[model samples]
Target chain A: MAENQKLCPMFEFAFELLGKRWTGLIIRVLLDGPKRFKEISAMIPGMSDKMLTERFKELEAAGILTRNIYPETPVRIEYELTDKGRALKPAMDKVQDWAETWLTPPDQNNGE
Target chain B: MAENQKLCPMFEFAFELLGKRWTGLIIRVLLDGPKRFKEISAMIPGMSDKMLTERFKELEAAGILTRNIYPETPVRIEYELTDKGRALKPAMDKVQDWAETWLTPPDQNNGE
Candidate 1:
């Protein structure tokens, strides 16, 4: 049906947030637990600090995650998912499953 | 754990493909059925023909979908997903479920 062909607005919105470079990896890292900026950057090797900072702002603005500042000898900053972001586990899990099933073994080199 | 913090390569590859703008939407549209370039462009409002064309090339190269050309008076062409792409239904479904649950309703205008 023609109606079925049209992309759902909500799905579009979801992808708009999720379908950015390093967003999924950032969320995936946070899904485990709160981590500081350096920690997240370290987890994802290719992602630059600037991109991580940009994604953090977007995710925070989207209500998917929150930035926490802890007062200590030196203030510590951490990024953690909100309930909404935590709920993305099932979806993220599904993506991981699909990746395992369809993606080639990581060891095998396929010329990019 | 430090080990757990590292991003999985397979997951990273999958997101690299899916995280690009309009990739998910294009795949989602094809999941319904095969359609021509014009049909796909029409279905997704605001997506220019150039974008759809680019995504089609990438998806084809990835072995996710194939382009079939029918030798007819008009030389009809259509694009369909391969098994690998079709297998993404579960992951896509999960994303849709998450969107329905967590994303704000389409009706409410939130300043972008």
Candidate 2:
């Protein structure tokens, strides 16, 4: 049987990464451009510092984000999307479009 | 500032659902067509029944999947994608395409 006969392993792996909580949001936040750790954290309210740090590390390891460290006395770190990461913008935009069309508020569905 | 000045809430909600474990796979499996519970279970090896059941229920609630039950003596249940769910195929295909291009196997990166 052809390898594509079944579920594509690579697709599954990508989904595995994107499916994680905060991962997609992190990517969305970074879409604007590179941002410092604190800046990204501020955009995602209620996100714990530990979780953000862990997710950033994971994204960096996955090659989705590039982390730059300044050589100054007080080190400055910023995260930016790699080429591969930027390619995901199309998929993310599609999801956003689908959500707006299909997902309505609960109150809108019923008389409240 | 315009409403689009910041992250869209609808996009966040869709990502929240898609980012869950097994949810994407479930959609992938159903892409072919409606399948019986056992059929889907067989296709996705290693998936626990409890987990599948839970995911299916959640998908139905999310309006992504429609469950059909027969009125025969022994009931038969099949799951099919709703219009919204089928609409996600484009996004899913993009993800699969991206995976093939960017997600090279670790072994391929170095001469092992």
Best candidate per DockQ, number? 2
lDDT by residue (tens digit), candidate 1, A58-88: 9999899999999977899999999999988
**What fraction of the native alpha-carbon contacts across the interface, defined at 8 angstroms, is recovered by model 2?**
0.44
Q: How many backbone clashes does candidate 2 have?
A: 1
Tell me model 2's lDDT, rounded to 2 decimals.
0.79
So what's the TM-score on candidate 1? Answer: 0.73
Instruction: Kindly report the root-mean-square deviation of model 1 from the true structure over all alpha carbons.
Output: 4.9
Local error of candidate 1 at B90, Å? 1.4
Residue pairs clashing in model 1 are none
Instruction: Tell me how far candidate 2 lies from the true structure as C-alpha RMSD in angstroms.
Output: 4.2
lDDT of 2 by residue, B1-112 (tens): 1233233556666766776667778898899999999999887776798999999989999889999998877989899999989988887777767877888666555656
Top-scoring candidate (TM-score): 2
Q: In model 2, which regions exceed 4 Å deviation?
A: A1-9, A107-112, B1-13, B45-51, B107-112
Error of 1 at A27 (Å): 2.2
DockQ score for model 2: 0.39
Candidate DockQ values, in order, are 0.38, 0.39
In terms of lDDT, the best-performing candidate is 1
